[model samples]
Target: MLTRKLGNTGYEVGAVGLGCMGMSWAYQESSRDDDRSVDVIRAALDLGVGFLDTADIYGDGHNERLVGRAIAGRRSEVVLATKAGLVVDDLPTKAMHRDGSPAHIAAAVDESLRRLGTDVIDLYYLHRIDPAVPLAETWGAMAELVRAGKVRHLGMSEVSVAEAEQAHRIHPVAAIQSELSLWTRDALGGVDTAVAGPAAAGAGQAGSGDVVRWCADNGAAFVPFAPLGRGFLTGTLHSATFEGSDFRAGSPRFQRDALAANLRIVDVIRAVADRLDATPAQVAIAWVLAQGGHVIPVPGTKNTRYLRENAAAVDVVLTEADLAALADAPPATGSRY
Candidate 1:
């Protein structure tokens, strides 16, 4: 697989990385097997897909512990990244709230390090800016983590251009992770037409400006989460039926009629994939890759077969004609949430 530099950190990671959220929380919770999830992470590392992404709030710390176990001995072979600033309020309900206070930032690092079984995190992202806390205070606290050597680099997620600029002034924003799939282009300065999830409030308002371009100008990596549209873009999601605990079970985009309309977007992706002799998942990921060299997408999954399929996207380049056809595809019917 090919690789790309991790922003100004000078670290080169897999062009397409693995998002470990599903293995722990969001999708198909009943099928989650720690042994299988661990193997998937290990398999990803073996395949050069070593940029592992997770968050402390995922499964209320379960995800971090799993990742800690997975990379126990082979930590050096991976560039581990995890997030803070979001606190899980209820494990059963998956309820969460933001806490960007200095105290929260300070304590969360120690907790994350303990759960991750690491001394220093390669990339530490403030999961979301707490509306109650000043951005500078939250970012300043994160910068102190770097100065204290507890964190190597700092990043942000779902922030507007103005918010990003504010934080970048305090410290270099190494990466900005947000929803940027075929249906979600809000990060590119376009209007967010879909209904997003709980954290969608942090997503920039309409005309937030092109954050992808901002990262390019400021030397930060633009990390696109859910590059496969939470499995909708894979062309394999033929039904709206999902587990009660699954995040998509209540998402607007996953409802029956909405999903039916969204399938048209997948149809276009499938056509391009067939032309390239690649899976729809790869075509979706490759389109994200075309966004920019610094764009590293973390498509989450617990299935090793899907992991291999996503990693192969590095070699699946879309032609100009393919790009044009995709660009002309109809808008999604439901919101991303």
Candidate 2:
């Protein structure tokens, strides 16, 4: 239930924000189970981790609607952030694509607002930049959303420093979300420059000590998603049970060769977990939290059992020695993408 200021946006959210993509789509094909999904979302709010992240492209807008319903009566108690720019709406061929043109952002915000069932979105992000369109034009459209009072803040995802700077010229970027984990480390100095970029509004992932320090010094709130490493760190993924259509199924880390080698990393984590009398998932979550007081890790779970265990991470604390041991784990075998 800890909190941090996202840059100087004059708004604050739970240090960690929930990524609702997997709830509706992406990662793996799954049933809707709106009732259960809603329950998990409310549970997160009750725990005070209220920055909910969703996108229009997720489930063709189902994710936003689910998030919208979850926060219906209790909207005021949570910080709602949804995104646009990734076009997943009833694709004729069901192909994934980008759409950051000014026209696309303009039209998408209305739909996101309507689907989210909110008057004003706390934070709106361009899920990814469109190579065909300029970033400045997209940010300009987002700036218009702010003017119309439909959006309060704007941010970008998986973008470079140059792109971020260009977008900020039109409007202040409130946050940046990219994949940053212990194993999927970003290019060194990547986050430092990102957090320090003009907006300084926020940088999404600072799950490591080095990244967190950069965010704090640069005035950016770090929000880490997939802090559980998509169930690998949870100790439920063994080589035999890992073959599936899920996102990790294709992950190099989950491949037979890489997974075999990666087990050693898990072994080290499990040793720490046993010492703390916690699950490896909990240990992983706790370690991310310990990276910095400002870092927030959102570990998603569809089932209440795992949800409860993950929530307990707010109490688990790793010592300096523990951190050093974790840092010394053998190098992972494959690239994160």
Candidate 3:
């Protein structure tokens, strides 16, 4: 696997990272196997996919514990990343609410550290900016953690460029994680109305102005989550039949009609993949890699085969013409929430 800088943290991690949410959180809950998930994570490390992403809200902390178990002995080989600030209301329905209060953040870091079985977290992100709490108050608390050595670096997720600037003034914004793919390009520029959580109400709607560019200029890394469009861009999902517990079951884009309409987007990706002798998942991830050197896409999976396949995406190179065709590909049909 190729390597990329994890912001200015001086840690070089694999260009492709792993998102551990699905192993215990949203998507096919019934099929989740802890033993298999552990193996997949350890395999990811062996393949140089050391940047592991998880959240405290995922499976109500179950995901972190699982990651902890997987990387217990091989801690030094992994660049561990987890999040705080989002509370899971219902594990079954996956209802969550943002809680970025300083007190909550103060307490959450200790809990995350305990669950991850690590003394210090490499990257600690505010999962979402709580509308109820001031961003400064929450960010100030995070900075305290860094000064105290509980966290090495601080990051933000799904924040506008202005918000990034606001937090950058207080502390160095090491990284910003957002939904960026061939379909979801809001992080590049323009308003993203499809955000979920408390941000959807007002905070997230503030246009994210060329955040990728902002990160590059400001010495921060842009981390893209769901670069595969939640398996839709893999050219494998022909039907909208998902398990009841799967998050996509309720997502707008995975609806029967919308999924059928969205297949056109996959067609373009498949055409590019065929020309490059790569899989659609590879092409999708490769296009994201082309965004910038500071960009790292964490495509999540619990399966070992998919983990290896996604890791190999770092080797796939897209030509300028291929990138142009993908840039002109049809926009997605449904809300990202």
Structural similarity to truth (TM-score) of each candidate = 0.97, 0.85, 0.97
Q: Model 2, residue 119: what's the lDDT? A: 90
Which runs in model 1 stand beyond 4 Å of their true positions?
194-207
Error of 3 at 290 (Å): 0.2
Per-residue lDDT, model 2, residue 122, is 87
Model 3, C-alpha of 336: deviation from truth (Å):
0.7
- Encode model 1's per-residue lDDT on 243-266: one tens digit a residue: 999999978889999999989999
Report the lDDT tens digits of candidate 2 across residue range 46-146. Answer: 87778788888777888889999999999887777778877753432234567788888888989988898889998888887766787777788889999
What lDDT score goes with residue 204 in model 1? 34
Alpha-carbon lDDT, every model:
0.90, 0.71, 0.91
In the range 1-337, model 3's lDDT, one tens digit per residue, is 8999988999999999999999996788889999999999999999999999999988999999999999999999999899998887777877677798999999999999999999999999989888789999999999999999999999999888899999999999999999888888899995574855542331243477889999999999999999999888999999899999888897888999999999999999999999989999999999999999999999999899999889999989899999999988988888787
Note the residue pairs that clash in candidate 2: 7-201, 204-223
